[model samples]
Target: MDWNERYSEPGFTYGTEPNEFVAAVAGRIPPGRILSLAEGEGRNAVYLASRGYQVTGVDGSEVGLRKAQELAAERGVAITTIHADLSTFEIEAEQWDGIIASYCHLPSAIRAPLFRAAVRGLKTGGVFVLEAFSKEQLNYGTGGPQSPDMLMALDELKLELAGLDFVHAVTVERDVREGSKHTGLASVVQLFAVKR
Candidate 1:
């Protein structure tokens, strides 16, 4: 899909609210330099920057990033942004205090390496927080990719991120209301881990 074209529309595809899971875990994360992966339109990045964290948003869409910059300006916060696809993005070693993967789902071939890169990108003791649609989301009729390959599984996450010390990892059916794109009861996996 052409994400840039999709984001070329007049408004944000997903509303301005940070993901619920990200909001819920905000307090547990000390404000620091954080990297947000597949950060579509910068809502989560802006939210973290508002909370005093230096946030950098990375996404593939230039139009989406421009919108994100607009949103950040509208909200009176600053966030660094990178327009690059996660598929080939190189994360620097020990560069971030925290990394957020909000709704960042990809096929195993892509996601697995991305997970490993995220680990290598974090500072020692850095935290990695993620919230994504689970495989069962196909039945939710709410949001996310229909292909099973694009959906996330908790077991897959565990296997991909085996080096981290898990703080919270669970799969559940929950209410997810974002923009028109994501709404209603949804199946998801939420993971929070710290690099030991």
Candidate 2:
């Protein structure tokens, strides 16, 4: 199935609220321009917008982007969205205060360049938050890309973000409720880091 089709079902795939980990640190994230990677249906983007953050959401699927806008309207928040393939999207340097990559799954080969772009997109001291499935997720059959190459662990993220200052990085098992697709005990790596 197409990426948008995977997310374009009747309900939100990851729910209509900000992620719990995101909510926990929401207070610390100073309001400013924010970019959300692979923002399927815009739950986090809309939530951030509601909290006074200027959010820019990017995704490849128009179907998903439209749903994201709908969610923003339903919540009475404003968010900027762009439909573009992250694989080749050129993220401007020093352009954002914060970036969020929540459950973005891609082959490692594809992930590297995209991740590098995510890092480069941030200004110095800008924060980047990521919560994604670990390879161990294959055991749980939870909500994540089934491909092992698409999953990640702390060690991998450490290597991928070699130059960043890590505020938090750990593998945690948590109950995730994101629409009907991402729910259950998810083995995830949560990282809060900043560019040097």
Candidate 3:
């Protein structure tokens, strides 16, 4: 998918509000630095920043990152933005108090290592939150990667992020109306885990 092209459109692709799951669980993360993966348009990052968490958003699309910064400024919240591919972006060990991956879909080859890195990147007692379209999403015709390889599975995620203690983990079909793109009933996996 050409994310740069998609983000270049007139408005925020995923809207300006934080993800519902993220908003619900934001308090679980200790106050400190947070790293947001695939943080397109800065919605989640800006929300966390507004809640007093230092936030850094990373995305492969420079255009998206630019809009993220603009949104942050517009929201009167400061959020750092990084333009880099998730597959190659380094997650420093024990550096983040929280790491979030909302709708960040990538092939397993890239996602597996990235998830492992996320596990190592969190400080002890830190939280890691994720919400992604499940493999079953193809049946819903909702927003998500069409490729099955890019969709996630709950059991697979548990294995990938093994060291953390799961606070919440489940697969559910629910209505998701985030923006112009993500709207409809969707199958998704949500995870909230804390580093031991």
Candidate 4:
């Protein structure tokens, strides 16, 4: 997907509001540096910054990151933005108090290593929060990658994120109203895990 082109459009592709799950789970994360992966437009990062977490948002699209910075500025909060692809973006070990991967869908080759790095990147007791479309989402057509390989499975994630002590993990159909792209009832996997 040409994220740059998508983001280059008039408004935020996923809206300016943080994901509902992210907002709901933010209080569980320790207050400190937070890393946001595939952070397309900085809604979540900006929201976290507003809550006093030092946020760093990383994304593949320069246009998206630019808009993210603008959003942060508009919100009167500061957040670092990094433009890099997930395949090559390095998640420094023991560097984050929290890490978020909301709606970040990628093929297994990239997703596997990225998820492993996310596990290693957190400090002990640091939390990892993720909410993404599940394989069942293909039937919903609300949003997310069309390819099944890009959709996540709860069991698969459990194996991929082995070191974390899961606080919550499940796949269910829920209403996801997020901008123009994602709307209506959708199938998704939500997870909140603490690094052991």
Candidate 5:
């Protein structure tokens, strides 16, 4: 399925509101240069921008980026957006103070490399925050890549992010209500780490 086409809907697929898990931890992130990965429709990026963070949003879809721009304008904040596929997009090393990966989905094959790139892109002591559906999300029938290999697991995250300093790592089933696309009891992993 063309994920980009799916995002072309008139309404926000993930909703206009930012992820609650993301919001809960946003306050902890000190203000600075921030990069938001796979920031479809720009909800989280715009929120971060509003909070006085210099935000840059990167995503694969032009349609999503357009919506993100609209969201930023709606919120009276400016955000820099880059259109590129995460699979190959290189995150600039030592450039970002924080990296936000909210619901960025990919098969394990692709995720490992992209995540590594994201980590390396952070400056020393840079914060990396992520929230993604766990393997158990299949039971929720909410929103997420359906393929098992595409879903995340605690063990997988532990290994993938082993080099980072983890401040919080947990896999839990929780209420997730965002755009129309993601709503219901979802199994997810929430991580807050700092680059060593």
Candidate 6:
């Protein structure tokens, strides 16, 4: 299904709350500008902005970003939204203090270079946070891509983010309640890395 089509519907696709892991670890993040990858509907970016972090949300769908902008406005927080494909989106080297990728899955060819870009985008001491469906998630059928190639593994993520120090990396089975699409038990790989 087209992402724009899905996002154009009424209400937020992923609901208004940030990811569970993101909310849990928000305190550990350093105060600075943050970039949220594939930040559909701006939930995470708006949350970060509410906490005084300068936030930018990038997504491929203009419709989704429009909703993000609306959400930001409703919450009285500011979030810059960018409409671009992750496969080609580029960020200046060391341009960001923090980078977040929540459920932004892609095929290996596209995901690899995007990860490289993410590493380069982080400044020294910058944090890189990620949460994505694991290959095992196909069995759960809660949400996320069905193909295994679109899913992530811990070791693979480590290699992709080799430029950063691994603060935390694990694959776990957890309950994900994000709107109607992403709800129920899910297998996911979560990462928290820092550039040094």
List lDDT for all candidates, in order: 0.91, 0.85, 0.95, 0.95, 0.88, 0.90
What tens-digit string does per-residue lDDT give for candidate 2 at 1-196? 3978877678877788878887777766656999999998888899899889999999998988999999999999899999998878888988988989888887888788878877888888788899888888888887788888899988878877677799898898888877787779989889999887
Tens-place lDDT per residue, model 1, 1-196, is: 7889888877778899899999899877756899999998999999999999999999999998998899999999999999998889999999899999999977889999999999998888899999999999999899999999989988889989878999999999999989878889999999999998
lDDT of 6 by residue, 147-189 (tens): 8999999888888888899988999999999998998989999
Q: Pairs clashing in candidate 2?
A: 13-178, 14-178, 14-179, 15-179
Question: Where does model 3 exceed 4 Å of error?
Answer: none
- TM-score of every prediction relative to native: 0.97, 0.95, 0.99, 0.99, 0.96, 0.98
Off by over 4 Å in 4: none
Cand. 3 TM to true fold: 0.99
Location of the lowest summed lDDT over 10 successive residues in candidate 2 = 22-31
Winner of 2 and 6 under lDDT: 6
- RMSD of each candidate? 0.9, 1.2, 0.6, 0.6, 1.1, 0.8
Worst 10-residue lDDT window for candidate 1 reads 23-32
Per-residue lDDT over 1-196 for candidate 5, one digit per residue giving the tens place of the 0 to 100 score: 5758978988888887777877898888867999998898999999888889999999999999999999899889999999998888888888999999899888788889888887888888888899999988988898888898988887888788767898999999888888787878889999999888
TM-score of decoy 6: 0.98
lDDT of 1 at 60: 93
Q: Clash pairs of candidate 1? A: none
lDDT, model 5 = 0.88
Candidate 6 wrong stretches, greater than 4 Å: none
Clashes of 3: 0
Model 5, which residues run further than 4 Å from truth? none
lDDT score, residue 25, model 5? 88
